[model samples]
Target chain A: MTSLLNALPGAVSQGLIWGIMAIGVYITFRVLDIADLTVDGSLATGGATCIMLIRAGLNPWVALLIAFAVGMIAGFVTGILHTKCGIPAILAGILTQLSLYSINLRIMESKANQPVSVDKYPLLVSSRHVGGFTLKNPIFLMIIIAIVLITVLYWFFGTEKGCSIRATGANSNMARAQGINTNSNKILGLMLSNGLVAVSGALLAQYQGSADVNMGRGAIVIGLAAVIIGEVIFGKIFKQFWLTLLAVVIGAVIYYVVLQLVLMMGLNTNDLKMLTAVIVAIFLAIPFWKNKIAGKRLGKKEASKDA
Target chain B: MLELINVNKTFNVGTANEKKALDNLSLTLNDEDFVTVIGGNGAGKSTMLNAIAGTFRIDSGSIILDGMNITSLPEHKRAAFLGRVFQDPQMGTAPSMMIEENMALAARRGQRRGLSWGISEAERTQYYELLKSFDLGLEDRMTTKVGILSGGQRQALTLLMATIKKPKFLLLDEHTAALDPKTAAKVLALSEEIVTREKLTTLMITHNMKDAIRYGNRLVMMDEGRIVLDISGEAKKKLTVAELLAKFSEASGHDETSDKMLLS
Candidate 1:
């Protein structure tokens, strides 16, 4: 019990990093109404770019910025494939992802996993705190990540460009009707979505102490699960745009906590995939369940009135 | 002002299912000219609006809006001068967005969209007053998602969105056809109110024989991709639904499938 409690803080920190990725997935899949599969590769792209640049003697912050830029370009290619070439969005994302898989391997140059020397140059270097706790603790790192993500995204979506993107999601036709240049919005949305996913990937790679080929597997699903869970739990409380993103962050943390609890209950790692599918299914059904229940009540009332 | 000179649009050209949606269609709308279009199914009433709105490129034609040759302009570019309310309530406005957000989008027509908040208090107030003209109580529900509204309310909101910026021309493709009779009447009245108050050069397509006769300053009856009957000025003011039907019969020299697809 003590070990579990001790682990909670670290797990939550990790969850926050993943939560940012979840928000990105939510934007594309839910807000933009796009089934973007480009996340998997773009994520590794972010991590690999950061790792490679850092190894080339670049400052950590500069490397992170470069990672974001690289992610944006990757997303932009996917956008062009879908909008200009008239490819289906899902297929466009798939094409970008497949192409990126090769690009990612090339970026790594040598092998899949490249763990930095813990003694020589570990990224996000650890330090001792006033409380004698290592500042490298996952909780502190996640707190910083969550704050940065929530604040930047909150401001970004509030801008005129944000409105354009939102309008694009609401109705592509209307966006065009109002001269909103939906093509740019779609590209921008994918860029923003993938950029955040890449940032999360970079952080995760560093936190886990290495970047692997399959690190981003099922990432899209987890992100989706976090978004759906957050939206459902927060409901109207997060109806405001800024609060909505915050809810997504919280939902991601909760999702990880739930996973931890499942593990604590003695569930096998084999069942994790099943658990994810079931969790996503339950959350997605919330709206449908409410509508069905509401219908039943209305029907019963009508029947009683008739009697 | 909007002008279409010999607009020709053929769907699936050079094939068995090939059909001319717009055939050598020519139309001119003067400033503030409210034109009503009526025809049986496949009369190209909606097609004419789509062509003008640049929904599809015509095979051959020139479309001039406000003195600019917009025939080659894309749909979004042409949308700056034209506002269109679709036959389906779901088409014009995003169902998931708030009423004010949709109006804000419309208000940004012809302007460069930048990085900024979706809607400001000032924009919301402007939208609220604009929507008040609809009399659908939507002005009070500015933050409500349009999906929650009834079909009539959504259509009314859509009309408001289309005209929020006082567009140069407004296209109404049976905007109220999906609503109940009472709601449809309410929306129709709101439509007339906005068109008159804004003095927008508007084109409306209606399936209802009576609605065609009642609204708009000019009435155009389309048959076989052609404007068979054109009524306007004081003469259109005195016309009735029966007279309008007779004119359709006289122009096409064919039986009116009027009963099969006519609304109301």
Candidate 2:
């Protein structure tokens, strides 16, 4: 138990990395009204791209940006498949997900499950500056990345373009009535959303010192879990952009904290999947519970009067 | 303010289910002409409006709005000069968004949308005043999500949003048909107020016969895919619902009871 407490920072740091992907998920699911299954494959796309580039001796920061660009192109293809070809959005996303598997493998060009050695990676694994304390690397990196990404996102959503994108999700015909090209907005929102997801994957690859082709399995679910939990908990406090992002970050932390606690309480590691499903179910059930409980109270009152 | 010259729109052209939605239709609205349109099911009243609004590609037509050749423009491209309200209350405003946010979006319609905080203090004040004008006290509920409002309130908010910048032309497709009677009256009244205040060129399609005559400086009646009767000025002022129905029978040679027009 004490050992798990000491390692709390590490679990939380990983959670922060996943939170970036969660926010990217929020953009598509909430903002664009698209259920993009592409994240599962595109995440590995980012991981593979970053690791391959870093292995080729590119700087991590530069490789990160390149990975983001690659994610954008991937998103653009999905958008085209949906828009130009008239495929249902979910199907288009699936097709992209399917295609990206081989593309990720091609990018890595390595046999599956080959972990990059932390000893040989070119970038700093732990972020420690002279003025600050040493935190397990991803936490510090996420703090910086989250700050920048959230700030930019906060500012962007308030803009005319961002509002239009949101409006596209709310009622697409209304957007068209107001001269908003909703099709373009949809494409733009997806590109941005997927790009962010990919950045997280890039960071994840570096943090774990490895890239796996199937690492992104159930990624959308995790992102959705973080988003729904954050919305339920802090949606009231963070009614708008920046605060909502902070809430997402907090939700990720809470998610990690709960997982760590579960572990400390002697839950088996093999049960993580079931635990994730259970935790998400609990959060998702809040609205139904409120209605059911309220209805029961009303029924009890009515019965007492009738008696 | 808007002109349609020999516009022809055919659905499923050259196919087994081919139905002519509009057939070489020609119509004109003079400056600030408030036109109300009525027709039975599939009578091309909505089709003419959609053609003008660029909802679909007409087979052949020249659509001129305020003297611009807009026959080839797509819907969003044409939306810069057009404000529209749909039959469904859900079509006009974002329910999850605040009334002010919806208004802000309408206010910026047709402009170059960008990644900057576009709403300013002056804009907020202007939006508040606009909401106040609705007289529903929505100005106080500027921050409220539109979903919580009654359908009437949302429809009124939509009306305000459509007219905020006063586009060159307005298209309303049975904008109040979906609301409860009381709420519909309130929204209809609001629609009348805004349309008259702006003296804007307008095309309104309505299922209610009384409302068809209650507003607008002009009235157009359609049969099949063509306008069979159009009245304006003194003629429109003197006409009643019964007389309008009789005129429709005289033109189309079918009793008013034969079609859905009289049923509404």
Candidate 3:
């Protein structure tokens, strides 16, 4: 119990970082209605880019920005493959993800892992400060970033271009009929989503003091888990857009907290991935199951009325 | 004004299911010409509209709209000058969007959408008045999602959206076919009111002969991807469903008539 309490802050910090990636996933999965798998690659791309740039004596902030731009380029490639080349969105993301693996390795100078120690570099956030109550703590910075990101996204989604993108996702036929270039809007959405995921990756690398090529493996599943968890828990309470985004971030925090508790209870770390998958699958199935049960009740009511 | 010269389109060119959807079809519409189109299944009525809207590239054709050649323009590009409502009530507006947001989208159809706010306070007032004019109490539910609306309400909203920003041409592809009879009549009346008020040129496809004759200034009949009958003014005003059936049979040299068309 003492160990679990001691590990709480670090898990929360990690959760906050992954929460940012979950926001990216929400944009593509919920808003654009596309299950974009490019985050698995772009997240590592961001980590690799940020750590490598920082190692080469660049400002950490600027490295993060460049990482975001690179991730957008990755998303742009996937968008083109889907829109221009007529590839299915999932397949397009997979292709970009496959290519990004090679690209991420190249960025790390053919190394599978690279480290940028907090002592040697001016990192933005670090796990070393996780337990601290100061501004230097990753928790403080992550909360601030989450607030700013959600606010900006809330505003952007209420704008003309943003509404058009929403329309494109909701009904492409209606969007095209209303003179919205759905293909361009789709490309823009993918770029924005992947860009956010990259920023999250950059932060994660800074927090962990290392960048690994496999740091972002199965990231889409994690993102989906966070999104579904958020929706299931706070979807009713967070009716507003910004609140929903905040819920996703909180959802990640909850996820990590729960995972910490499970680990303290003697769960093997090797079984962690499978547990996450199962939890996500169950959460996802809840809505479908609810609908089926409701339909059966309605059917029974109509039958009773006939009798 | 709009013109389609020698438009041709064929689907599945090399397969056993190969069918010519459009074949050397040509059409012309003058300013404010409210034309009604009628035909049996496979008569290429909807295909003609799709061709005009640039849903797909034509095999051989020139489509001129307001002195601009738009034959090669894509659907979204062509949408700048065209307003369209489909047969399905769900096709014309984004179901997940608010009613006011859908109206805003329609209001900016031909304009470039930038970083500006999607809906303005002033625009909200205007949309409120527009929705009020529908007399469907939609004014009270401006923030409601369109998905919650009934089929009749959605169809009415679609009509309003299509004409919110006056297009050079309006296309209604059996837009009221999916509604209940009373609701269908209400939507049809709303459509006529909008068309008349806007003085917009339109091509409305209908399975109902009465609606085709009673609504538009001109009537056109198609068969096998070709226009078989064109009537206007006193002649069309005097024409009955029986006369139209006779005319269709004579023009196509077939006694086969769609029972649905007759029944409707």
Candidate 4:
């Protein structure tokens, strides 16, 4: 219990950082209704791009901007594959993710891992500043970033163009009938989502003090876990768009807090992926199960009333 | 106001399932003409509507709307001039959106969609007034999602959306076929009232013979992807279901065996 309590702050920090990535996932998975796998690679791409740019003696903020641009390019490829070439979205994302593997390695200069020491370079957020009350603390920085992102997204989705995108996600047939260019909106959504994912990767690289080729492995799963967790716990109350995004961030925090407890219970680190898959699978099925039960109850009530 | 010249569309072009959905079909609508379309299954009535709406590119033909060649225009591009309602109640509006938001989207049809707010306070009042005109009590549920609405309410809303922007032409592909008979009648009456009030050009397809006979300034009967019979004004007003059946048999040179059109 003491050990878990001691690690709580660290868990919260990691959760907040990853929460940004989950919000990106929410854009594709919930908003655009696409299960994009590009995050698995673009996240590492962001990390690699940022780390390499800093290694080349560039401003950290500038490196982050470049990382975002590169991630958008990756998303553009997937969008073209899906819209222009008529490939299925899932397959398009997989192709981009596979190609980004080589790109990430090249960005890492053929190295499997690269480190950016906090002492050598000034970073936006770092684990070294985890317990501090200063501005460099990852928790505070991530919260601010999350709030900014939610605000921007809320305002954007309320705009005419953003509503068109939402309409595209809701029903493409209706979107076209309403004169919305659904294909273009879909591509735009993918770009925006991947850009944010990359930004999250940049933050994660800084926090972990390294950019590893494998850092983003199974990242999409974690994102889905966070989004699902958020919706399951807070979806009932948070019906508004911005509130839902906040809920997803909070869901990430809860997920990490639970994960830390599980780790403290002497679980092997190597089995973490399997556990994550199990958790996400169960959460995904919960809504379906609830609906089925509710439907049966309704049917029984009607039958009894008729009798 | 709209012209479809010899439009041809074939589904599954060379496969065993190949079917010529539209076969050199040509149609023209004058200003403010309300034309009711009637056809049996596979007569290409919906296909003709789709061809005009640019749901798919025609194999060989030109569609001219207000002197603009729109045969090559994509579906969304052509939507600027067209208002469409589908047979499915759920197809014409986004179910997850609020009632007013759906109305706002329709109000901006064919206009440039920039960063402007999706739904404004003024638009809300206008939408409430428009929805109130339907008399379905939808004005009070402006913020409610369309998914919770009944079929009748959705169809009514769809009708409103189709004409909110005052499109060049309205295409309704059996829009009320999915509703209960009473609701269908209500929707049909509302459609008639709106069409008359707006003085808009319209092409409505229906499986119901009574509706085909009772409404519209003109009637078009399609058979085997072509217009076999066209009646207008006094001729359409005096036509009966049995006489129409007789005309159909005479036009097609065969005894009508299928009850699909006549039964409805």
Best by lDDT: 3
Query: Would you give the TM-score of chain B in model 3?
Result: 0.97
How do the residues B12-63 of candidate 1 rate in per-residue lDDT, one tens digit apiece?
9789999888878888899999999988888899999888887788899798
lDDT of 3 at B189: 91
| Docking class of predicted structure 1 | medium
RMSD after Cα superposition, model 4: 1.6
lDDT of 3 by residue, B1-264 (tens): 899898888888899988888878888999999999998888899999999988888889799988889999989988988999999999998998999999999999989999899999999999999888789989999999999999989989988899999998999999999999999999899889989989999999999998999989999998888898999888999999888888888888876455345424
Model 4 residue B122 CA deviation (Å) reads 1.2
> Per-residue CA lDDT of candidate 2, range B62-142, in tens?
998778899999898888988888888888898777777898999988899977685777888988887776689888888
Task: Please give, for residues A169-284, the per-residue lDDT of candidate 4 as tens digits.
Answer: 98899999989998899899999989888988988998899999988899999999999989988888999999999998898899899999998888999999999999999988
The native-contact fractions of the candidates, in order shown, are 0.84, 0.83, 0.88, 0.83
Clash totals for all candidate models: 8, 1, 0, 0
Name the best candidate (by DockQ).
3
Q: For model 3, what is the alpha-carbon lDDT of residue A13? A: 93
Which of 1 and 4 is the better model by TM-score? 4
Tens-digit lDDT track of model 2 for A82-132: 888999999999999999999998898855654666567665343222123
- Could you report the DockQ of all the candidates, in the order they appear? 0.75, 0.73, 0.89, 0.88
**Fold similarity of candidate 2's chain A to the true chain A, as a TM-score:** 0.88
- Output the lDDT of residue A274, model 2: 76
- lDDT, candidate 1, equals 0.82
DockQ of 1: 0.75
Model 1: residues with Cα > 4 Å off, grouped in runs: A125-132, A285-307, B13-17, B257-264
lDDT of 1 by residue, A1-307 (tens): 8867866766677678888898888889877999899998888888888877777778777887888888889889989999999999999998999888888888888588776544455577322111236776656767776788788877877777787788799889878888878887899999988988888887777766667766777787788888888888896677887688888888898988888887988999888978898878887787899999999999999999999
